[model samples]
Target: MVYEIGDNANSALKVVDRVTETLRGDQWQPTVSVNEAREKVRIFVKQTDGLVDGLVVMVVGEADKHHGDTGNEAVFVNIVGEIDPAELGRITKKLNIDVDV
Candidate 1:
């Protein structure tokens, strides 16, 4: 089932914590970690017939830049299945613009 993560910061943090624990376990080893301060995170899951086909975690935030440099940053995590990379890109774009992703 699709779960819409709540908009509250605490809710987002909770989801991140749960996902972190899951990733730390042997069952699910995330390819990368983008846990950072003041970042937005999105978890995408594509499912069919009650079975998950793909999963992606995206994190966006301001880049750590030198003086006078524009700061921009983005992170995309693909967990499983054959979900389109472009689709994940679109989701990330939307999440970057939306405060309540």
Candidate 2:
């Protein structure tokens, strides 16, 4: 399960940042962080030994959180490929997120 981050594209990207902010050290290599649209963003991460070679993570948020949203939560997170669970857990813990795989 994922967390209800926020509404709108910016919020979705912020979630990505929150998850990646601590992805430092020689073991991690972030290739790019790009905004595909006003309401979407994608981030690619590559482990030194090439653990993840595809879309590391991407997020898409609703344009209008209040249009038909009652709870106003519209952030969507998509993670592709795989990473070391222990490393991921350490990162998530610092971000106040839970890791369960």
Candidate 3:
């Protein structure tokens, strides 16, 4: 799975494709971990159609504790089988956002 912190929908989807492809294969568990700098980060994966048709990726991040706001942010992405690295690269370039891992 792809791990990223995007400010919008399009960029978040691109990050998912990029991360999923980079860690392809059964041995690679779909997981995303936000660094300690982030107050909180949670990733949830739900398999649809018996894990074949596609997957739902949900990411949630909490506001920085120092900011005095306890709100949270979230991003959701739906992915079909196989990701195109070229396409992902293009989105990454356009969005200018970094994938966590």
Candidate 4:
């Protein structure tokens, strides 16, 4: 579900939106916040999953740097505990994002 470096930003927004909606009302708390200066969104998701209290998934993304340059400026998402990495990977792949968890 990857998109071109110069592709649809709306799709990214939708992915975040979907993820947010899916999290609502669950014991897991998904925090969505933005950094206006960077034009990026940061997501922090955590869930107990009836196992232990910890993180679930962490993801981040932003437009690719211009002219092939590496741009550190991008969206960020972080998940901290025992979670389904496969599902998280699916979300990131679709969103064309990167994360550190």
The lowest-lDDT stretch of 10 consecutive residues in candidate 3 is: 38-47
Worst 10 residues of 2 by lDDT: 69-78
Which one is best on TM-score?
Answer: 4
**Which pairs clash inside model 3?**
2-19
Candidate 1 TM-score to native: 0.38
- lDDT score, candidate 1, position 79: 55
Over 4 Å off, model 2: 1-11, 48-55, 64-101
Summarize candidate 4's per-residue lDDT along 44-79 as a digit string, tens digits: 555554443443332334544564634333243444
Candidate 4, superposed: residue stretches over 4 Å from native: 1-5, 35-38, 47-101
Per-residue lDDT tens digits for candidate 1, residues 1-101, read 22333333455456566766765563443433545565655564656665556775756554434545254444446657755545655655654434232
Selected candidate, larger lDDT, 3 vs 4: 4
- Put down candidate 2 lDDT per residue, 11-84, tens digits, no spaces: 65666676666554423455544444333433445543546533354444444544664332333333556756
List TM-score per model, in order: 0.38, 0.38, 0.36, 0.42
* Candidate 3 residue-wise lDDT at 30: 52
* The 10-residue segment with the lowest total lDDT in model 4: 52-61
Candidate 3 error regions (>4 Å):
1-32, 37-57, 65-70, 90-97
For lDDT, the strongest prediction is: 1
Query: Mind giving the per-residue lDDT tens digits that candidate 3 earns over 1-101?
Result: 33444443345545545655654543344544444544222233334444533333445454565878454455555656744434544543333335443
Error at 44, model 2, angstroms: 2.7
